[model samples]
Target: MAAYVGRGVHGQTVRLLGTRVLAGELREGDTIDLGALSTELDLSLTAIREAIKVLAAKGLVDSRQKKGTFVRPRAQWNLLDPDVVSWQVAAGAADTFFRDLAELRAAIEPAAARLAAQRRTDEDVVVLRAAIDRIAASVRGTAEEETAADLAWHRAMLAATHNEMFTRTDVFFAAGLSERDRLVHGAVHDDPVPSHSAVTEAVAAGDPGAAEAAMRALLDKAETDLRRATAMNRRAHDDHERGSTA
Candidate 1:
């Protein structure tokens, strides 16, 4: 159901795949074939047209006469667009697209964490600590409460990193972070307090390495849980396919 939700346009599926595509390197003025993509995704030309138009709004695809739609340079893509990220997430032909994103998070968040630790001010520490405490408080609160606090904590981390690029992207990350936990992390069964607190303490203490490692630990645990869920889903999908064929 989840995988299919990201299906292609024009009778194809819609997905909420996020992050991986926009982060890539794009050259200046790359031409793309709407016709080809339509055939590949088994969507109609109309569907492809509408989809590309949306991409164009995001500065991802530019359409001109005597030439079909073309991919804009990487700098132009609207990384913050929720639909764009979801589409990117759905565009993958292999399961690895998501796994790679998870793995990439594991690699990058740590470095970002380290930076935040070294650069964070006292106020930043207070904000992050407060967010962490809120997560703890919310654990016993309603589902919506926990979700909001968790995202707040993540945004604080992104801000503490003090990287404009990282900070700017927080809305996107915060929107998808918990969903990633739910889909990839087996419903976030493990408590997030311990996971997030380590990050806060390290940053508060100005321990760059520890901050990075702590952030990595949280993501690594997520990756582990995500892998489990993905494997389980794949096996179930394969069995379904086999049974249908049989």
Candidate 2:
């Protein structure tokens, strides 16, 4: 489907640039000067019109008979919509994206571990043991195999808890598991599961405190891994930038 650019496209381009420049400061009943907006963006009126139409459909802006366009309230924003995230990133509003993802982990992971400890079945343990064994066997092999085993191990770990949330989150992360796999996969020597296994065993044995502590250790490892991955990405990005300039 073709996307609308705003009134003859000029309006759309003008409006898009206006909204981004004044994204956070929008208020109802605030009249925008179409001429001034065009001058500021250095774009044609046709382009601005097209940009406005897109933003209007997105509910970020409203156009009235004569009141011009105004920003919508925050409550009306569709935050979880994928397009919204993409727009924010394009607009340079995602500085804390990864940090927020980790914050959600701190909120949800420990409880997931504790529940797995208390609810794990004997069969679940056996399955998890097999997954860990697969991971160990994949050493010095293909990264794809290591990633599959890592994802399987996480699913097995979540199985110990029987909590839907853990499993649901795992599903989301598992789909993107390869986001880290190519970098960290097959790089194992010491097992990542000793701490994870302790949590599962404690859960199966009905030990709450030990289960929680063990899960914490497993999560701590994750945080460390996440940091390492992020640092690597930054270094890569910097190298790319330098190479481009050179």
Please tell me which predicted candidate would have the highest lDDT against the true structure.
Answer: 1
Over the full model, what C-alpha lDDT does candidate 1 score relative to the true structure? Answer: 0.67
TM-score, prediction 1: 0.61
For 96-160, candidate 1 gives per-residue lDDT tens digits of 44555666566567888899999999999999989988988887666657767877887888889
TM-score of each: 0.61, 0.55
lDDT of 2: 0.62
> Which regions of candidate 2 are displaced past 4 Å?
1-95, 164-166, 169-172, 175-191
Candidate 2 differs from the real structure by a C-alpha RMSD in angstroms, to one decimal, of 7.9
The C-alpha lDDT values of all candidates are 0.67, 0.62
Model 1 clash count equals 11
